[model samples]
Target: MKRLTITTLLAVAILSGCSSTEEVVPDVPPAELYVTAQQALQSGSWTTAIERLETLDSRYPFGAYSEQVQLDLIYAYYKNDDLALGEATIARFNRLNPAHEKSDWVLYMRGLTQMAQDRSFMHDIFSIDRHDRDPEPARKAFRDFKRLLDRYPNSQYAADAKARMIFIKNRLADYDLATVDFYIRREAWIAAINRSQQIQKLYPDTQAARKSLPLMLTAYEKLGLQEPIENTKKLIALNPVN
Candidate 1:
């Protein structure tokens, strides 16, 4: 939903015409295409890998390397920043091979793809405050990684998934903190206090919670609530961010 329409049609487009300029001929044998795709992947040429893999997929549906081709194509899409195609291709792979042994890897890639979505090169170069950005991609990535762990606890990607989940949690906490800051800047004391209290309750262990303690105290002081201000000060004292 974030990128392109997540539908079977998108999957078809991923197979048929992923690259507008590079046309892949269907006459090539699947093995040759697989070899070429592998070379492209090894050389870190994502566009070339995607072209060869898509050709193999469309031309030889049940070919010997179909499963691997789909997986490789998904990886290529991610490397090329073609997140929507990667997502759609992942969905297609799960639909076709429900119980495939590599499904755990696919799940990890799905999370990785969503995690890498909506990122901007300018944002990376600039010291941008991105807590204001949409948190849906982080949420989706969290969900994907959670599902991966739920289904396959022993997966090779489990450790990295757990690490990503931690970052996702911090991202959500930061988003909530950003909203609290918005209310604070607007002089909406009650709204800010409410949201800051929510942050303290929901993410008490997070760095946002540590930041929120002061914000909540500020909100309380602004509202002339001495008791709340004192309580928030105590929270800040008790929870020192290290």
Candidate 2:
């Protein structure tokens, strides 16, 4: 009886150990989870896709698939129109995997986020009507595009970034020229000349600067600034587009 009782206790111990091991074991592999997330993305279920990808990242942080999931999470956020979250996730991915294969894509996405955050023309019109021209978003977009150009000059998005930078620069120059025009209208020739000089110095190649030169020349004449008039002439002769 004692031997039988001892055997039963041993059997119970073995069964308990097996049950514990089974409980600890994962039901689905990380790869399976990743595939499900991809399927969710393909199905246009962005929230679910992001959730699964995030889960994979947390559970299998050091796996090769985790890195891919991190990138996928960025895309998922972008697809969901969550630009702020997408940017944040991309930044985190960049910090973790600076040398990742898709780092260029991350940079490009960041630039796109900045572009998206820019105020619309309608908003600009509203602000202008209210005499509250908030140009901060445009300025931020310019800075972000500049960063992309400087850091990833050879990236696939570099050309687009450069084009956008040119566009932003032109807009900025236009704003400056408008201010100078206002000063000229007020007979503040010195102020007008200074504003034009500022544009010329900062954005020599912009069309706004070219357009401002003739006005600048007029301002210099009205202000009786001979040296500036000659310098303006020299600039026009050098540029030949004014």
| lDDT of every predicted structure (CA atoms) | 0.87, 0.77
Off by over 4 Å in 1: 1-20, 23-26, 125-129
Measured against the true structure, the TM-scores of the candidates, in listed sequence, are 0.86, 0.60
Model 1, span 1-242: residue lDDT tens = 63454465457756766556866455766777788889999999888888888888888889888888899989999999899999999999999999999999999999999998846644654556687788899899999999999999999999999999998888889999999999999999889888988888877789998998888888888889888778877888999877
* Model 2 regions lying over 4 Å from their true place: 1-33, 40-64, 121-153, 178-191, 214-242
Candidate 2 structure, TM-score to reference: 0.60
Error of 2 at 4 (Å): 89
Model 2 lDDT tens row, 29-135: 88788888899999998877877887787788899797788778888887776778888888888888888776777777776666655544345533543212444
RMSD of each: 7.7, 19.1
CA shift of 128, model 1, Å: 3.5
Clashing pairs in 2: none
